[model samples]
Target: MKRALILAALVLGLGGAGWWYASQRDATGAEADPPTVAVTRGTVERTVLASGVIEAGTLVPVGARVSGQIETLAVELGQKVKAGDLVAVIDSLDQQNEVLKARADLAQIEAQQASNAASIREAELALDRTRQLNRTDLASTQALEAAEATLAVRQAEARALAAQRDRAQVALASAELALERTRITAPVGGTVVAIVTDEGETLNASAETPTIVKIADLERMVVKAEISEADVIRVKPGQTATLTLLGDPSTAFEATLRFVEPAPPGIAQNDAAETTEAVFFNGLLDVENPDGLLRIGMTVQVSILLERASDVLTVPSLVVSRGDGGRSTVRVWDPASRTATEREVRTGIDNAVTVEIVEGLAEGELVVAARDSDTASAAVTMRGRRSVFGF
Candidate 1:
């Protein structure tokens, strides 16, 4: 009886082990199917992301052409100014003296020219009288010759004075321009964004023009976006773009692509071979800022639209897996069979979030976006298909 009871206990243990194994297998089978998302008709766009800075479409730096001390700064920072409005004043005392000298020199040349003209007229009259007397035998040929020489000398003097007068006139004009330069004015209509030089600061402009202020037209703004080298080819002028300031991300500013610079900014200054850094090209976009909300130097995020499609079939970008030969595939789930089958699809633009499905997929169809980890087979399959980057 003891041997029979031991054998029966062993039999019961075997049965319990079999039941546990079967239950685990059933649970694994139930969770093996991957999670799915429905493919639907929607809009999709391909875009390139870039960071940018706000800049004035028309920015001009007001500087002094002549060196002098800043007598008065008329416009302060953030003050609105129109074209030709007085911006600042340099010490005009020296410029005034120079102007006076130029005018006096010009006047002297003019007076000399007038005197020479009178001398020429008197010499002509004397020559005419000498010639008449010589014909009547009253004057000698020597007297006629002397009068002719005097007239020629006076005419030559007049010509010299006329040339001097021209030089004097140019000098006067230049001096007047220098005087005008002392009274700095806005070259463009905009706000005074920066004050580089202050009153009482002497500006030495002999070497270079000293900047007194920076003026920017806030009504229309330009964004200078730094586009990575990889994306530079995709971006082009006339493309639509959207800009959002870091200060206000929710508010988007609509803009248009102006142009992409041929080379990176400051590239000429940098040694190409020695520079071992990522290169980025500048892309410009124009946007209107009538309210003056967009300020210069404001950091911004920019999105350039490369391609777009409307009312097309789309799926989450991750759901579509890329295959060899540039083919795209997605796993379509069959509700009746309770299984997913791989389906080849032709894709259009992908905006990183949603991908446009051109063919091989239908609306309302379910596509496996991801798989459960419990299903090692499905997980491996999904991993292999996700290797494709942005389309």
Candidate 2:
């Protein structure tokens, strides 16, 4: 009786222990299988991310070559203009006076030239008369010499006058050009984005040309993307890119990368190593803005496409284990055996979110995305497909 009783107690204790162990496993969610996601077919793109700004492809600043008070502002801000269109007019009273002075100087020189010519003619006639008289012995040699001297003086005067006339003509042309410069015109066809000098404002262009207005071609734009030095090596000209404006992020603007600067903007080649700050190179991309929605100085998100794979078997990048030998492996799940098998896979493109499986994977086959932990096995999302596991 004692032996049977001891056996019964041992059996009861074993049963209770098993029940407690099973209940604890279920309560902690350790009894649940690991989260698995099916291999999906989708597009995978490898891109370099960057931040950029939208700028006019062709930006030109209209300035005044001659300094004066701005007399008229022809166009307002946001006004569209064509090349050579009148942008602004400066006060031309002083320039007009200068032109008049030049004209007067030219006229005086011309009159002097005419008078010199007349005097030369008279001297030549007198010299000829003296030469004839001397040939006949009617005039002294002194008279002939004096007449020749007078003729030479008059010819020399004519030459001097000719030089003066040339000088005056050049002065007149310069004055006219100065006057024309008072009328500022657009150098390129674009929209007026800025007005630096308003009407009635005095501009001092003696040291540097003062800008009157800013114009930009809004029909097409260039995105100046700042790519880090680490990523600049992968970017190249003629690569396709996509831009999303901060204001309109839902719409993607397609662009073509025009060029990537060899060095950072405003940083000289020799000074690159002198600064401890992070360096970034500019990548230029051309985008068409037919609707005129893109504005200058607008912020943009840039993505430069480096590689792409279409309709390929893909899985979450987290599930992939990479070894030092460049071998990639994944844990494939078998529903019938309730076990996961580790298998090697060839990966084509990895964009971090999804990785393309080139070999050793098939569609509809489940792969362990995360280990069976209370926190990890609850949910797994890959390429818009969600897997939910129950404890």
User: In model 2, which regions exceed 4 Å deviation?
Assistant: 1-33, 266-272, 371-391
Q: lDDT, candidate 1, residue 3?
A: 69
Tens digits of per-residue lDDT, candidate 1, 187-295, equal: 8888888999998999999999889999988899999999998999988899999898887899998999989998778767774523478889989999999888998
- Where's the lowest-lDDT run of ten residues in candidate 2? 375-384
lDDT of each: 0.86, 0.88
| Per-model TM against the reference | 0.78, 0.82
Badly placed stretches (over 4 Å) of model 1 are 1-34, 270-275, 321-329, 334-344, 371-391
Cα lDDT tens digits, model 2, 239-283, are 999999887899998999999987677566575453478888899
Locate the minimum summed-lDDT window of 10 residues in model 1.
382-391
Report how far off residue 4 is in candidate 1 (Å): 32
